[model samples]
Target: MWSTEDVARDAARRQGRGLSTAQVAEKVAEAARREQETRRQLDAPTETEIGPFATDPEHLAQLWAAKHTEWRRIAALLKTSGEQAYDPDRDAQGVTWAQERHARRQGALDRHAAWMRERQDARDELRTQIWLPADTSRRLRAIAARAGLQPEQVITQLADHVRMDEDGAVVVAPFTPHRVEGS
Candidate 1:
């Protein structure tokens, strides 16, 4: 694989070609514009079909169960690794690789925690904005209780169905419909 230094050298060589300074600057600007445009396109939301918003308590429950199972699996793996047994005296002064690995793991955990907190906050906010009937809310809460999730999870999942597409057109998610007959 080409190293960063190699890449820089290649770029310098390309710049040192017969092209004038103004030409090089123009080429760089054009490349930057193309990169920005590509990123914008990638970030843009695609068109989606809108349908009724229906929240399946069973599905939510299954999802929660799966997440719990995955978490347990991860915990088991960590336990087997013996790394979970912390040792304060584990010196990293001579173990640069281990120190780097530990730093990466810590960074990943920190990022995961931050993402989880942000997701929880967003779910809470979404729940407050949901305008489901009292009976529906009650049913949802009941389902959530059975599925090991908070009522807010049901509300947030349903809320996700009510969103606009890139063109500002209302696009409802198929799974979470606006109304369920007996919900």
Candidate 2:
């Protein structure tokens, strides 16, 4: 992982002129500032941008599929060009590199699809919401930590032990805490 300073130093060295420590530091700072500005420009949304489509699964899928097709077309073209200039000795490593790159790209798309499916599934699942006092929430978290369970899981399990009394009061059975190995 090369830092801005390393890149600046390398560029200066290539120019065949030795720079003082202060000059090298100044160059590194200038390079870093420019890099940051470029990143900001890239991250900012464009005026011609389409819908955000974050909550629209079908539209997001279509976008992803289109991008995947474009990547596949580019990869195929590169492969065709490489084959046209074949050199067994020189391209043995190139073949391995190309295969690895293709696999990585495919894996990224596969992972994205899996994540989209998870988001869709989550939307379909039933859920309940309740508000608890800040102190009670903290206590629940502590209990969950001691039991090696998530706070939500602790609450779900507690629901099984809750009952209603004749006087319309809620009563809960004694909770049996799970013993953690180190605790």
Q: Using lDDT, give the best candidate's number.
A: 2
The sequence of per-residue lDDT tens digits that candidate 1 reaches over residues 71-152 is 3333343345445322223323213433555576689899999999999998866223658899987898787777566777
The regions of model 1 sitting more than 4 angstroms off are: 1-132, 165-169, 175-183
Against the reference, the lDDT scores of all candidates come to 0.50, 0.55
Q: How accurate is candidate 2 locally (lDDT)?
A: 0.55
Give a tens-digit lDDT track for model 2, residues 1-183: 333333332333343133333443454455455445544544664565457753333433343343333333333433555443223233343345445655766898899999999999999875899899999999999999988887887887787688999999999989865643553
Error of 2 at 75 (Å): 57
Clashes of 2: 0
Q: How close is candidate 1 to the true structure, as a TM-score?
A: 0.22
The clash numbers for all candidates, in the given order, read 7, 0
Q: Which 10 residues in a row give candidate 2 its minimum summed lDDT? A: 1-10
